[model samples]
Target: MARERLEIEAPEVAVHLDAQDPESLRRLVLEACQRASTVRTDHEPLVDLALSQLVRGTPDDNLARKLEELAERTDDRYLTAQEAADPNWATLFRSARLASALSLALREQTRSSVLNSIYEAAHASPDTAAFYRDLLL
Candidate 1:
Protein backbone atom coordinates (compact mmCIF):
# COMPACT_ATOMS: atom_id res chain seq x y z
CA MET A 1 0.00 0.00 0.00
CA ALA A 2 1.14 3.55 -0.68
CA ARG A 3 1.94 5.66 2.36
CA GLU A 4 0.02 8.93 2.82
CA ARG A 5 1.58 12.41 2.66
CA LEU A 6 2.98 14.11 5.78
CA GLU A 7 0.50 16.92 6.39
CA ILE A 8 1.67 20.32 7.72
CA GLU A 9 -1.16 22.75 7.75
CA ALA A 10 -1.00 25.83 9.95
CA PRO A 11 -1.52 23.72 13.04
CA GLU A 12 -4.80 24.66 14.68
CA VAL A 13 -4.83 27.75 16.85
CA ALA A 14 -6.25 25.46 19.46
CA VAL A 15 -6.92 21.77 19.14
CA HIS A 16 -9.30 21.10 21.99
CA LEU A 17 -8.87 17.99 24.10
CA ASP A 18 -10.91 16.88 27.12
CA ALA A 19 -9.42 16.04 30.47
CA GLN A 20 -10.04 12.33 29.99
CA ASP A 21 -8.77 12.15 26.44
CA PRO A 22 -6.13 9.45 26.16
CA GLU A 23 -4.88 10.94 22.91
CA SER A 24 -4.46 14.33 24.57
CA LEU A 25 -1.58 16.65 23.67
CA ARG A 26 0.40 15.73 26.75
CA ARG A 27 0.28 12.05 25.84
CA LEU A 28 1.74 12.81 22.42
CA VAL A 29 4.60 14.79 23.93
CA LEU A 30 5.31 12.06 26.47
CA GLU A 31 5.33 9.45 23.74
CA ALA A 32 7.68 11.48 21.58
CA CYS A 33 10.08 12.14 24.44
CA GLN A 34 10.11 8.44 25.36
CA ARG A 35 10.84 7.38 21.82
CA ALA A 36 13.63 9.93 21.56
CA SER A 37 15.22 8.63 24.73
CA THR A 38 15.69 5.21 23.16
CA VAL A 39 17.85 6.35 20.24
CA ARG A 40 21.44 5.52 21.28
CA THR A 41 23.95 8.24 22.06
CA ASP A 42 26.79 5.79 22.89
CA HIS A 43 28.62 6.22 19.58
CA GLU A 44 27.76 9.92 19.34
CA PRO A 45 31.13 11.55 19.96
CA LEU A 46 33.11 9.11 17.81
CA VAL A 47 30.52 9.47 15.08
CA ASP A 48 30.80 13.25 15.30
CA LEU A 49 34.61 13.24 15.12
CA ALA A 50 34.75 10.65 12.34
CA LEU A 51 32.12 12.53 10.40
CA SER A 52 33.97 15.82 10.94
CA GLN A 53 37.25 14.24 9.80
CA LEU A 54 35.66 12.99 6.60
CA VAL A 55 34.03 16.36 5.73
CA ARG A 56 36.78 18.62 4.39
CA GLY A 57 36.90 21.03 1.47
CA THR A 58 37.32 24.57 0.07
CA PRO A 59 40.22 26.97 -0.71
CA ASP A 60 39.41 29.04 2.38
CA ASP A 61 39.08 28.02 6.04
CA ASN A 62 35.67 29.68 6.45
CA LEU A 63 34.31 27.94 3.38
CA ALA A 64 35.75 24.63 4.60
CA ARG A 65 34.09 25.16 8.02
CA LYS A 66 30.76 26.00 6.43
CA LEU A 67 30.89 22.92 4.23
CA GLU A 68 31.74 20.73 7.19
CA GLU A 69 28.82 22.17 9.14
CA LEU A 70 26.47 21.34 6.29
CA ALA A 71 27.81 17.80 6.07
CA GLU A 72 27.31 17.25 9.78
CA ARG A 73 23.71 18.56 9.69
CA THR A 74 22.79 16.42 6.66
CA ASP A 75 24.00 13.18 8.21
CA ASP A 76 20.92 12.00 10.12
CA ARG A 77 18.43 14.54 8.77
CA TYR A 78 16.88 11.73 6.73
CA LEU A 79 16.44 9.59 9.81
CA THR A 80 14.53 12.38 11.58
CA ALA A 81 12.28 12.90 8.60
CA GLN A 82 11.81 9.14 8.55
CA GLU A 83 10.50 9.47 12.07
CA ALA A 84 7.80 11.58 10.41
CA ALA A 85 7.23 9.12 7.57
CA ASP A 86 8.58 5.83 6.21
CA PRO A 87 11.52 3.70 7.20
CA ASN A 88 12.85 3.67 3.65
CA TRP A 89 16.26 5.24 4.20
CA ALA A 90 16.73 6.01 0.52
CA THR A 91 13.47 7.92 0.15
CA LEU A 92 13.97 9.63 3.48
CA PHE A 93 17.44 10.84 2.53
CA ARG A 94 16.16 12.16 -0.77
CA SER A 95 13.51 14.07 1.16
CA ALA A 96 16.15 15.45 3.52
CA ARG A 97 18.23 16.89 0.66
CA LEU A 98 15.07 18.32 -0.79
CA ALA A 99 14.12 19.90 2.53
CA SER A 100 17.61 21.42 2.86
CA ALA A 101 17.08 23.18 -0.43
CA LEU A 102 13.73 24.28 0.94
CA SER A 103 15.28 25.34 4.26
CA LEU A 104 16.55 28.70 3.07
CA ALA A 105 13.08 29.86 2.10
CA LEU A 106 11.85 28.37 5.37
CA ARG A 107 14.25 30.36 7.58
CA GLU A 108 12.45 33.64 7.12
CA GLN A 109 9.91 33.30 9.92
CA THR A 110 7.05 35.63 9.30
CA ARG A 111 3.60 34.17 9.65
CA SER A 112 2.93 30.71 11.05
CA SER A 113 1.79 29.66 7.59
CA VAL A 114 5.16 28.33 6.42
CA LEU A 115 3.36 25.20 5.35
CA ASN A 116 1.51 27.02 2.57
CA SER A 117 4.73 28.39 1.11
CA ILE A 118 6.29 24.97 1.48
CA TYR A 119 3.31 23.50 -0.29
CA GLU A 120 3.69 25.99 -3.10
CA ALA A 121 7.42 25.34 -3.46
CA ALA A 122 6.97 21.58 -3.31
CA HIS A 123 6.71 21.21 -7.04
CA ALA A 124 9.87 23.20 -7.63
CA SER A 125 11.83 20.93 -5.31
CA PRO A 126 14.94 19.19 -6.54
CA ASP A 127 13.22 15.85 -5.90
CA THR A 128 9.91 16.87 -7.39
CA ALA A 129 7.69 17.32 -4.30
CA ALA A 130 9.02 14.27 -2.47
CA PHE A 131 9.60 16.22 0.73
CA TYR A 132 6.20 17.83 0.52
CA ARG A 133 4.67 14.39 0.22
CA ASP A 134 6.76 13.36 3.19
CA LEU A 135 5.53 16.40 5.17
CA LEU A 136 1.90 16.03 4.19
CA LEU A 137 1.43 13.03 6.39
Candidate 2:
Protein backbone atom coordinates (compact mmCIF):
# COMPACT_ATOMS: atom_id res chain seq x y z
CA MET A 1 0.00 0.00 0.00
CA ALA A 2 0.99 3.60 -0.57
CA ARG A 3 0.17 6.79 1.31
CA GLU A 4 -1.07 9.99 -0.29
CA ARG A 5 -1.91 13.56 0.75
CA LEU A 6 -3.95 16.26 -0.90
CA GLU A 7 -4.39 20.03 -0.94
CA ILE A 8 -7.70 21.64 -1.78
CA GLU A 9 -8.40 25.17 -2.92
CA ALA A 10 -11.30 27.59 -2.49
CA PRO A 11 -13.64 28.69 -5.27
CA GLU A 12 -13.70 32.06 -6.91
CA VAL A 13 -17.17 33.52 -6.59
CA ALA A 14 -15.81 36.55 -8.33
CA VAL A 15 -12.69 37.35 -10.31
CA HIS A 16 -9.44 38.51 -8.78
CA LEU A 17 -9.53 38.60 -4.97
CA ASP A 18 -7.57 41.75 -4.12
CA ALA A 19 -8.76 43.64 -7.20
CA GLN A 20 -12.05 44.01 -5.32
CA ASP A 21 -12.72 47.27 -3.47
CA PRO A 22 -14.15 47.86 0.02
CA GLU A 23 -17.85 47.73 -0.91
CA SER A 24 -17.35 44.46 -2.74
CA LEU A 25 -15.47 43.11 0.25
CA ARG A 26 -18.36 44.16 2.50
CA ARG A 27 -20.86 42.46 0.21
CA LEU A 28 -18.82 39.25 0.12
CA VAL A 29 -18.50 39.19 3.90
CA LEU A 30 -22.21 39.83 4.38
CA GLU A 31 -22.93 37.23 1.73
CA ALA A 32 -20.87 34.73 3.70
CA CYS A 33 -22.82 35.62 6.88
CA GLN A 34 -26.18 35.51 5.10
CA ARG A 35 -25.15 32.50 3.06
CA ALA A 36 -23.91 31.11 6.35
CA SER A 37 -27.48 30.31 7.44
CA THR A 38 -29.38 30.24 4.14
CA VAL A 39 -28.08 26.88 2.91
CA ARG A 40 -28.76 25.04 6.17
CA THR A 41 -32.42 25.18 5.13
CA ASP A 42 -32.12 22.55 2.41
CA HIS A 43 -30.35 20.14 4.80
CA GLU A 44 -26.86 18.68 5.08
CA PRO A 45 -25.83 18.44 1.42
CA LEU A 46 -26.90 22.02 0.99
CA VAL A 47 -24.91 22.88 4.09
CA ASP A 48 -21.85 21.31 2.51
CA LEU A 49 -22.52 23.09 -0.75
CA ALA A 50 -22.99 26.33 1.09
CA LEU A 51 -19.66 25.80 2.80
CA SER A 52 -18.02 25.00 -0.50
CA GLN A 53 -19.38 28.23 -1.90
CA LEU A 54 -18.68 30.07 1.32
CA VAL A 55 -15.02 29.27 1.63
CA ARG A 56 -14.25 28.24 -1.90
CA GLY A 57 -10.76 29.13 -3.03
CA THR A 58 -8.77 32.10 -1.78
CA PRO A 59 -11.94 34.07 -1.23
CA ASP A 60 -12.27 32.63 2.29
CA ASP A 61 -9.21 34.53 3.41
CA ASN A 62 -10.72 37.76 2.16
CA LEU A 63 -14.17 36.78 3.43
CA ALA A 64 -12.80 35.78 6.83
CA ARG A 65 -10.70 38.90 7.17
CA LYS A 66 -13.70 41.00 6.17
CA LEU A 67 -15.94 39.11 8.57
CA GLU A 68 -13.51 39.57 11.43
CA GLU A 69 -13.16 43.28 10.63
CA LEU A 70 -16.82 44.08 10.03
CA ALA A 71 -18.76 41.39 11.90
CA GLU A 72 -18.32 39.00 14.81
CA ARG A 73 -16.57 35.68 14.24
CA THR A 74 -18.06 32.28 15.07
CA ASP A 75 -16.31 29.29 16.68
CA ASP A 76 -17.26 25.65 16.37
CA ARG A 77 -17.29 23.45 19.44
CA TYR A 78 -17.40 20.43 17.17
CA LEU A 79 -14.42 21.63 15.16
CA THR A 80 -12.67 22.51 18.36
CA ALA A 81 -13.16 18.90 19.36
CA GLN A 82 -11.88 17.80 15.96
CA GLU A 83 -9.01 20.23 16.34
CA ALA A 84 -6.96 17.51 17.98
CA ALA A 85 -7.69 15.32 14.98
CA ASP A 86 -8.29 17.01 11.63
CA PRO A 87 -7.74 20.64 12.62
CA ASN A 88 -9.68 22.28 9.82
CA TRP A 89 -9.83 26.07 9.79
CA ALA A 90 -12.54 26.43 7.17
CA THR A 91 -14.80 23.78 8.64
CA LEU A 92 -14.77 25.49 11.99
CA PHE A 93 -16.03 28.75 10.50
CA ARG A 94 -18.64 26.95 8.41
CA SER A 95 -20.16 25.11 11.36
CA ALA A 96 -20.25 28.00 13.78
CA ARG A 97 -22.78 30.20 11.97
CA LEU A 98 -25.12 27.28 11.41
CA ALA A 99 -24.98 26.39 15.08
CA SER A 100 -25.50 30.01 16.11
CA ALA A 101 -28.61 30.48 13.96
CA LEU A 102 -30.12 27.17 14.98
CA SER A 103 -29.53 27.85 18.66
CA LEU A 104 -30.91 31.37 18.48
CA ALA A 105 -34.03 30.36 16.55
CA LEU A 106 -34.66 27.42 18.84
CA ARG A 107 -34.33 29.58 21.91
CA GLU A 108 -36.66 32.16 20.45
CA GLN A 109 -39.29 29.58 19.55
CA THR A 110 -39.09 27.38 22.65
CA ARG A 111 -38.50 29.71 25.56
CA SER A 112 -40.57 32.40 27.24
CA SER A 113 -37.98 35.07 27.60
CA VAL A 114 -37.06 38.51 26.30
CA LEU A 115 -39.52 39.65 23.69
CA ASN A 116 -37.76 42.64 22.13
CA SER A 117 -34.27 41.25 21.75
CA ILE A 118 -35.22 37.92 20.28
CA TYR A 119 -38.74 38.59 19.05
CA GLU A 120 -37.91 41.80 17.27
CA ALA A 121 -35.40 40.07 15.04
CA ALA A 122 -38.00 37.49 14.11
CA HIS A 123 -40.79 40.07 13.75
CA ALA A 124 -39.17 43.26 12.55
CA SER A 125 -36.73 41.84 10.03
CA PRO A 126 -38.56 40.24 7.17
CA ASP A 127 -35.33 39.15 5.55
CA THR A 128 -34.06 37.62 8.77
CA ALA A 129 -37.33 35.81 9.35
CA ALA A 130 -37.47 34.70 5.74
CA PHE A 131 -33.89 33.49 5.88
CA TYR A 132 -34.56 31.56 9.07
CA ARG A 133 -37.90 30.29 7.78
CA ASP A 134 -36.21 29.27 4.59
CA LEU A 135 -33.39 27.63 6.58
CA LEU A 136 -35.53 25.88 9.20
CA LEU A 137 -38.79 24.72 7.61
Write down the TM-score of every candidate. Answer: 0.22, 0.27
Tens digits of lDDT, candidate 1, 36-129? 2222333334324323332221113343344335434644865666676756544434333333222322233222223322332343234434
Tens-digit lDDT string for candidate 2 (11-121): 122223234564454333334344544422314553344345434322333333333332133354435557767555444444444533323322212122111112222
RMSD (CA, Å), candidate 1 to true, equals: 14.2
* C-alpha lDDT of candidate 2 relative to the true structure: 0.35
Which candidate should be chosen as best, given TM-score against the real structure?
2
* Model 2 residue 29 lDDT score: 38
Worst 10 residues of 1 by lDDT: 11-20
